[model samples]
Target: MPTGVALHDVRGQLFDAAERVLVREGPSALTSRAVTLEAGCAKGVLHRHFADFDDFLAELVRDRVARIDGHAAALRESAGTGTVTDNLTRVLPDLFDPVAVAVVSLVTSRDGLRARLREARPVGVPILTDAATAIASYLTAERELGRIAEDADVGTLAPTLIGAAHMLFADRQGVPPEAEDIGKVVNAVIAGVR
Candidate 1:
């Protein structure tokens, strides 16, 4: 940021900056001041745009959750271009990125933040739940095309796969699960039911 230069905030810029701060420095480092500094804007910019820091943080979490939902729902984007397993394996990685992991950790540990988020979205759609639902819908579509077994229990399998994914990468101390690891898990889950 050049001295005295006015930098306009593009939508999501502050959110991206906050995510970066969380990933690099941890949740305690994510203040509105830090985000504005990272975003190269005035400190008051965040307050001006949002009711307060909690509202802004909730929005960021909401945005990431929505992004995950969008990504899960876009399973068809790879339809016909790759095997069903391949498409699902690709989408699975989006759930375990460092930024997302940090956000999840931060939100779950803070009751106030959690309450703010729930208030912001009254329907109380958990991101993981939405991801599982979207994954099931995709699997159902594939099953319709004979990719999955007709008797496959999609409802049970969806969350099982998602839960497996969460366990594999949600651990902060371990090395993040690689694509091969995710592929093995996805294959096993699909094979057991499909």
Candidate 2:
């Protein structure tokens, strides 16, 4: 935010500001006014774009979910090209970033926001489900190429992997897990499956 700076992609600006606040100050710092001040927009701009603070938060979480989902989808291209651990290590931790964890916590704490999210979907945030599906899809493709063991239970393992990753990320608080740490987790998971 600055003097006389034109607002472009105000939605993205607000979301980015919201993320910075959530990461730097924690979930309690998230508020319409806080986001507007951080984004350098009119105090009312956030309210103007969404029905309420909860709605704004839902959208923010949705945006992050979509971006991470897209990353998982792209993992298909790396199928059979790398070890399963390598491919998963490259992406699973991306799902558990501090901003993402804070957004999820923010949404879950507010019943109204969580309800709106459920109304928009079927259950909890789809980040994990999306990742699981993406991982399963990649595994299936690899199986076809004889990369994965035919006996591997991808259907069961994919979700288990995602859940483990979720725990790993949730435990991080604000500190980001290093790629090596992710590699270790992925290695442990893959060792069980392979």
Candidate 3:
């Protein structure tokens, strides 16, 4: 008999497990065995769902990236409500959460994973690229509402903010940056535009 789970939603269970492994041990530790162990499922559980380890990783990345759409919508909805700095400060950490940073490392370190991801995300790194686009869209909304300067270069500003937040959050291992630190960076990035 096969040793594994017959649980519903196994893909979600495995993805969550992989994120835990990524945050706790970084990308090098994210093997299918490690993920199954973290998930408390048998090793073959992963192989059953995915063609291979890289396929699982690519799907994991895509699932996370798809979440950015929801975030982007929420951020855009807040365009006229909060201060631009406050809105951005709140969203940056969400965008650069520990799992996301680890995913970036995973994508960069594994060429096979990168190649697999490129079919859907051909331009930039997976999570970060989608995040930058989300930020840009939010900033554009704010600009249209007269919250940010009409002259604000949202295209340029979005990536700059993402890059800065990525640096701050990426250095902490599994720990997140303080809200104060994130606020400072957000304030600085939007200062010229506001």
Tens-digit per-residue lDDT, 1-194, candidate 1: 33565556544888888988888888877787899899888777778789888888888887888888668657855555578778888888786677777887778776778888776555433566677887888888887777778888889898889888877877665688888899999998898655
TM-score leaderboard ranking: 3, 2, 1
Query: Where is model 2 more than 4 Å wrong at Cα?
Result: 1-6, 171-174
Point out the higher-scoring one by TM-score: 1 or 2: 2
User: What would you estimate as the lDDT of candidate 3?
Assistant: 0.88
> What are the RMSD figures for all models against the true structure?
2.7, 2.4, 1.7
lDDT string for model 2 (52-164, tens) is 88889889878988887677777888887878788888877676677777776676667777788888787645566667888888888777877778877888878888887
lDDT of 2 at 169: 83
Better of 1 and 3 by TM-score: 3
> What's the lDDT for candidate 2?
0.78
Best by TM-score: 3
Displacement of residue 17 (Cα, Å) in model 2 is 0.7
TM-score of 3: 0.94
Q: Which candidate gets the maximum lDDT versus the true structure?
A: 3
Residue 90, candidate 2: Cα error in Å is 1.2
Report residue 84 deviation for candidate 1 (angstroms). 2.8
Write the residue-wise lDDT of candidate 3 on 1-194 in tens digits.
Answer: 24644767999999999999998888888898899888888888889889999999999998988888888999989998968888888888888877888888999989999999888767898888889899999999988988889999999999898989999988745468888899999888889988
